[model samples]
Target: MDEVSPEETPSQKVPPWLFRAILTGAVALGGLYVLGWLIAELKMLIVIVLVSFFLSFALEPAVNRMERLGIRRGVGTGIMFLALLAAVGLFLWAIGTVLADQIGDFADDAPGYINDIEDWLEDTFDIEVDAQGLLDEFQEGGAVANLATRLADNLINLGATVLQVLFQILTIALFTFYLVAEGPKLRRNICSLLPAERQRQVLSIWNLAIDKTGGYIYSRLILAVISFLVHWLVFWLVGAPFPVPMAMWVGLISQFVPVIGTYIAGALPVIIGLLDQPSTGLAMLIAIVVYQQVENYLLQPKVTAHTMEIHVTVAFGSVIVGSLLLGAVGAVLALPAAATIQAFLASYLERHEVVQELEDAEAAQHPEREPLGDRLRQMLDRVFTPK
Candidate 1:
């Protein structure tokens, strides 16, 4: 073979367009890789913004009400924030008191309860349950196990969670404050970026989104409270243990996770009742079943309809799809996403007369060319004709 210099090869002398095309492809691929990372971070930022937006919306009515009574916006906002903080503190204190009482009760009766449970299961179901085996499996070490092992573990976890919650709360508060303060300016700036023809559409979309989000949050809060109170009263009536605390937990957690709330809410009380009293557990189960029917047929329709205007099928499908995508987070977000899509569709239908006209023109042009109908009509005409 002949020796080839570095620049003498035919392959080395690439066409300008070919070289540019390869360079472009490489640049595009690099840009896309960076974009994916940016999108993930952006999603986190959007979630934070949504949290703040909802908090501000929830507090807006209070702030506006305060302003109506002659308070300045700053003062109103501050007062509303303080009121929220105070309410949260009071709620936490109440929860702590109830939890402590429940814990003490459980601790005092745990051994007796365990013995009773073992005896009951053996007698009722002919099955032997080993309480010690469970305890032994859970017990893993010395100093960690010595200082009230479960309590220490719980406290450590709670402390970590509290710190995280505090950080989130601070982030939410800062975001909410700025959102409330600069909301109008932000809206204006966003609108200013669009062309004049699109400005209206943008504003409409923005308003619709805000309305839907705020409405969803408020409606959910109301529903959660209603569910909590109903479950608490029912559980108390049915002689379930820790009715208030368990009911509160069920209500809050269920509301946080959509579509499965009723089932999840029913589970804890039923389990506790089973452990405490089987007959009472059965009664509680029946009560929960009945209440879920009432809620599904009556309360959900009335509450969610006012907020979202989505069909029941759409709502259920959205929840399922959401759960499938992001687990619990997806389920929680699904209703809003559905509502947003519905709103977008409605807006498109309302604004796009040209689209409707085009569709109509196309339909008229095609006119369902029915050869059978034409032939049938012609035969009828021939038969009826007098010659």
Candidate 2:
């Protein structure tokens, strides 16, 4: 074979446009990555938008029902908004009352709790304990003063956070109202952009996502109630202090959190029980474990399956990955995200050529025949009159 000349070399002959395209793609990808990072950094805004979207979907049925009852769309939306506000306010008030009572009880029993802790530590480790000495040392070193200062700072920060949260809620509510009012038009506008052939699939996927998200929210609310009741009953049976308050807190928090939620919720009861009586603490731990098992195997399956078909393994994995990426919020949002992703993938697969072929084959093999009446008439004619 003839040796290739320098000018004719394959690498040298590569088009300039190809190199330009590669460079342009690299820059575009880099910009997109940066943009994604910025969006992640603005997590609070993202959370508000997500909350608004989910709330709109969750409340749509109620709004529609109200409309069916001769209410105008605006009136229906307004009533839903007011109802939501009232519910939130009532929940907050209840939580506040319980927390106040628990705090007072804690204060009244502080000395006893401290003494019990000291006794347990001394006995368990076979060492002398000096609570007074530690306190004196802490005060002398100005640690207590520093702690007070830090607490004050934290309180101020917390107040600011509360204000910010209120603002976000107001924004979300306003946005949710608009979303509910204009959702139909918005949906139509979105579908109008897609090709006619693809619109049905796209709309189906959208419906699947909304239904799944709404179902998940409803199931979680139910689960929270069940968890609260079960925990409260168990705590009362075991004579755990502040059972109602603790159970409510545990239920609400665990519902918001994912994989590690049960453990966190179990911690408070166990600690309080241990402080009161060690044996009760052990019993409380066993109760928590058993209840979680039941919830996972029985309650969760029945409730969540109706909305989104996801495996427990997938849920757990999503939570783990989410936690690694964005802490508690990620873990809380993980299941919905996973379900949405799965819906998209499933819709895509259902539209694929292989899936269509398989379905067609199955249809051909089990072709639907005519009605029994038609078959009977044909059989009678063949038997009585046909030659």
Candidate 3:
């Protein structure tokens, strides 16, 4: 080969260190891409596990109380699960009974309501409206008929969705049982793997997370109960049929679900109220509005202040972010997740130093400048002087 400088040599063209660094970066990026794909594939499993994690916290206090009463952790977990199952069964039974009754009522009164709607549209807008004719058109092949077909298909899909939800609930129960029963052992095992200082830090964080999660759950439960009782009274006063079930639905849904929960919860009662009597629905809507304002301004801050340790805007924003990222499960867990993160940061994150400098007074900084009020007064004196 012709004489070549080191820079022209093949080995020098790609330096060994640079080549290795490039290879390492490519490997890391490839690994991350693979991890993302894997996570996407197991998203449903991740959701189930997250739900289980939340349930573990929700059931933890009950299990701890049982453990304090000298029950084995396993037995405590079992008792807790039994109670939960019984409560769920009772809730389901109540919902089923009320829905069956109301569905019949709705069916019987639907035609009259439809006629009322048609009459109102005609009178208000001076447009001819048809209830029976619309049904006839739907029965015949048309755009409305296509919509009916799609709705029927959706109803069929609803059964599958319900089954999936039941499966998720069962999976969550199993995970929560294990997590509660073996929690101590799991902590010990994890601590055993770390150095003494790290072990202490890890254990402290774990306890903090549990404490925050438990407190949030308890606070939310109290708020939900209060909401249920107050709304139940309001519904009863308004003479809404199925007030008890409606109240329960509103309380639980509004408290557990974030952001739009109040609106969604209120919608059902208002709809029922409207269907039963227009004035009742209007009153129910007004009552809902007033209660929401009171709750937002008063009750929410008081109940959740200590437990959440986050601003109302932060809490609501987190729920929206969580929903966007992971749907309903994310929304439900967002508060606890945020609390845990905040607790960790408070404990371990480096504190920001306070500045020693004092703020400069505007008059001192600019001695010739007169205050706005004095300047305005001087202008007024000049304009309105006895000249």
The numbered model that scores best in lDDT is 3
Off by over 4 Å in 1: 1-18, 40-46, 57-71, 79-95, 113-161, 239-253, 320-330, 350-387
RMSD list, candidates in order: 11.9, 11.9, 9.0
TM for every model, in the order presented, reads: 0.68, 0.72, 0.80
Candidate with more favorable, higher TM-score: 2 or 3 = 3
Local distance difference test, each candidate: 0.76, 0.81, 0.83
* Model 1 Cα lDDT, one tens digit per residue, 129-211: 99987777667645446768789899999999999888877888999987666666777998888898899987787667667
lDDT of 2 by residue, 158-267 (tens): 99999998898789998899888777788899899999978998778767767777777778889999999999999899988778877877787777678767778888
- The residue ranges of model 3 lying beyond 4 angstroms of the native Cα positions read 1-13, 114-160, 356-387
If ranked by TM-score, best first, what sequence of candidates would result? 3, 2, 1
Please report the TM-score between candidate 1 and the true structure: 0.68
Clash count, one per candidate: 0, 0, 0
Of 1 and 3, the candidate ahead on lDDT is 3
Give residue 295's lDDT in candidate 3 (0 to 100): 73
Clashes of 2: 0
